[model samples]
Target chain A: MEQIIDKYRGDSTAMIAILHDLNAAFRYLPREALEIVSDRLSVPLSYLYSAATFYRSFDLEPCGEHEIQVCLGTACHVRGSERILDALSRRLGIKPGETTADGKFTLKRVNCLGACALGPLVSIDQKHHGHLTIHQAERLLEAYKDEHD
Target chain B: MMIEVKINGKPAEVPAGTTILAAARSCGVNIPTLCHHEALEPFGACRLCLVAIDDAGRQSIVAACNYPLEHSGLVVETGTSAVWQARKMSLKLLLARCPGVKVLQDLAREWAVDTKDLLLTEDRGEECILCGRCVRVCREVIGKSAISFAFRGVERRVSAPFDQEPDACLGCTACAFVCPTGAVKVIEQNGRRLIAPWHSNLEQVACKECGRAVAPLKMLAHLRGLAGEENEQAGEGVFCSRCRRLKTAAAVTALPEVKFPGPFMIP
Candidate 1:
């Protein structure tokens, strides 16, 4: 945390960058970590929390080891992305914003990935698996599960 | 330097960089506003102050509260049909959000806005218009940003960090005082000040002379710190407003009077 604050030279304007680094390191923002950042930067904790909540990228809760982001953008939705999301939710036994009980996978729905041509897109651990079918997505999840086991 | 601008075809000269709302008010033109406060910075959050502007035949609608009068000969129409339509739409949306608020209802009736055709989801019975006055006053004026707007979209609201009791709140009630919609409430009970919407409970500091409950202890400490005083003795010589006034009057009566040579008349 001190390194991250020092990296930004303790500049208040680098709040977003510092938060991003913290998120990357911890996979989510811990409440105590945010307090330390606020104290070190002399920025208000409420302000930092406001920014963290406003942006979708920052997760307040601990994320699962594997992240699965399904695009719910206009083009993707038109191509039956919601159906894919529902299928995954049932298979994983967790909703879009929830992490699995074993903390293996966290499912999220993103607005866009800027890749409209690949409608019904899904990204697993930042690796894009576009033009996916429900069966293929299940198989992909199975691969990660096998690797973990 | 002053710049000339015509508001609703009435010529008015206002200083440079003045907001259109201020310029209109200076010329006796009234622009209805809910989120505007003279003490705070212009936060164009509420869209109720929209007005039509025609600068050299280029026309556009802008919020009068924050839109500055940068150029001369800018024609501002406060009561144009477009302006009324915009304001009515804004009110209609606000009514849908806060159906129980009387101020929004009155504004809707005055503007003749019919929300009959407007379909609303569940009535949340919420009064906060998200005007951000309390947030701005706490951050800008009081210099303590104990509360802030959290979340986004329809789920957005003013809250303390993590929706927990605010750690930094002074219980100053400045947020409650500045809230236009009376959304923030300060309740005093059992010698404690409870700032609602954040649920911060602070012990009230008593006046040293009379032992009456004064301001909140944390708020007094904050003020004393602002005054560049050490906080070791938090309760020493502190007096409430009434006690302080009486003390000043008594001290004035006890002072010896001295005659001045010249008449103290201002030129």
Candidate 2:
């Protein structure tokens, strides 16, 4: 596979931009891919590690295939959002930012999605679900239960 | 072969696969860190370790710990004003809730953050630093997802799967140690809850007056509820409801006591 170095072509100005795009797209810059870029452009490994670790958007770990992001925003508190989150935590048997024992689900929490209307929202992948009571959430999570697949 | 990065407009030779954070560390450039720990994998959830990367053709803040060195020639800026402000503000917000913990206060002092805005908004309850390290360690290292992150945003916490007290926790302090905020405190209270992961442990503090062991707080209230002014006068420290009622009745009524012994009578 070709390294993502063609985009940079020794142009340090363009190199950072390309890496950012790759990371934003994948949420984690592939280690091999990064090595290829570093080799082609002659950038130091220390710099790359530094850049990766210093930023908030990058992830050295693989992104969760199925992301369960709970909103812990301020408005969500007044709405008893903790109950919804707690219920999800129970049903999944994993806390936020953790994948299940089976590796099928990865739970995480975000501060705010700016979706105050959907206080206490839990989004699976890209699908957003909100306004969850424990009862409501149990029904919603039935989709993840074991099935004869 | 090595890659070249422009540091403050100077091209520098570096080894392959170096993140900006790693590079800065090697170069003795101090990039402030709060959530990033050397002993653990990169968890970008903190948002404090932001560095400007000239990637995607524009500069945006990305966590250096997780963002990789996928390019050779990138413009990176650390310790910028915007980055410091974001970290300071985040620390302030975290400190406002968990003032009981001293680490947050120390961090605030180190950063010289004296903001009244963070003080303006305070919420009651346990403070969770939201580092995700404890939650991650509890699962990844300990193999028991005994305690995990609950809630979202600032309201988030590292807790049992259901916030019902872990029915599976081995009473291990793994989660507690990695926790930047001491939000999750595990006391060796005996088996009282519906379910606990570990062996049943509970404390039964009884009523101080009746010697009846109830919950410690419950005993205090019960003693208060039964305490009468007469009990205060006699100074035996209040009695239970049954004893208090009997004492009050004994005091109110002129009891017909068939005296057995009197100092004034000769046997």
Candidate 3:
């Protein structure tokens, strides 16, 4: 933690990247890391969380090893993404924001993954499945349904 | 004029077309605003992203994303006293008639907008933050001016040719995707039922008589394609409320008027 502070000593401008780095390294940013970040960079903790929550990329919750992110963004919305998302949700037996009861899969909805060309995109643990149909989205989830269990 | 920006007090070269919003964010200064999205054009409508720049010239409240930078030996306060007050009030006004949204809830919490004791205003039924992200993305990115901002001031909203259905949209969910709230929807039939994520609850159809799940939209749409009823729709969802009442009256009126004061108590 002291090293984290020393790396950004008086260089308050490197706060966003520093927080991002901490988040990447620790998965979800630990509260202690945030406290250290606040104390060292001289930013309020509330302000930091506020900043983190503003952007759609950051996550405060613990993610499962096999993370499943559905593109509930609008372009996909018009392209029959609900069926795909519903299939994914039903196959996983979980809602959009919950990890499976088994903890092997975590499902979440991102505003847009910026892959509009591939309407109804789903990323399973960072591996993006593009141009997903309800058939395709379900097939992808079907593979994961038992792998973790 | 090249502006000298001490990002966290370390000087960096910033030229013109630099909105104060982009400059501060690049320098580890985080100013949160609702209407600011990198994918769309700058909508300075939401005044939450204000930054204070103290220089030799006239200093004032500037929207970072829209305000251009000039040659000035400057001191920029990312969260100054005046900036915070103005931002908080702007947030409150925006939330006054908030559509009771979770995304807005998260943003509201971050900007420290008061939740308690603040009066709630009428909802637009559509939770369009008026960010213009949808309109800009559709026009600029999608290159379809099928939808544009209609009306002005607080009454402004993104609408189709005449707020009917989008003639310009390719049935693409671009606007729906960019919408901060789930208002616009694209519906399609899967087997017999209607499925779309634009609404929280799905329009389900049960038998008007037996209460059995009878995919009404599909049944009606299919029946509507028939010869004489080319317009006469079938299924429970097709008939207008009053039309159905009149038709039911005409059908059952000739029969014995069955009247029973009924509360069936299961024993």
Question: iRMSD per model?
Answer: 0.4, 13.6, 16.7
Q: A13-43, model 1: which lDDT tens digit per residue? A: 9999999999989999999999999999999
Candidate 3's docking class is incorrect
Alpha carbon deviation, residue B210, candidate 2 (Å): 36
Winner by TM-score: 1
* lDDT agreement with native, every candidate: 0.90, 0.62, 0.66
What 10-residue stretch in candidate 1 chain B is worst by lDDT? Answer: B116-125
Can you list the residue pairs that collide in candidate 3? A74-B177, A75-B173, B21-B64
Better of 1 and 3 by DockQ: 1
Candidate 3 lDDT tens digits, B153-179:
455555553334432344445666676
Candidate 2 has an lDDT of 0.62
lDDT value, candidate 3, whole model: 0.66
Q: What is the DockQ of each candidate?
A: 0.85, 0.02, 0.01
What shift in Å separates residue B238 of candidate 1 from its native position after superposition? 2.8
Fnat: each model in turn: 0.90, 0.00, 0.00
Clashes per model (N, Cα, C within 3 A): 0, 60, 3
Candidate 2's displacement at residue A69, Å, is 20
Candidate number of the best lDDT? 1
- For residue B98, give model 3's deviation from the true position in Å: 1.1
> Which parts of model 2 are misplaced by more than 4 Å?
A1-149, B7-17, B123-125, B153-155, B186-267
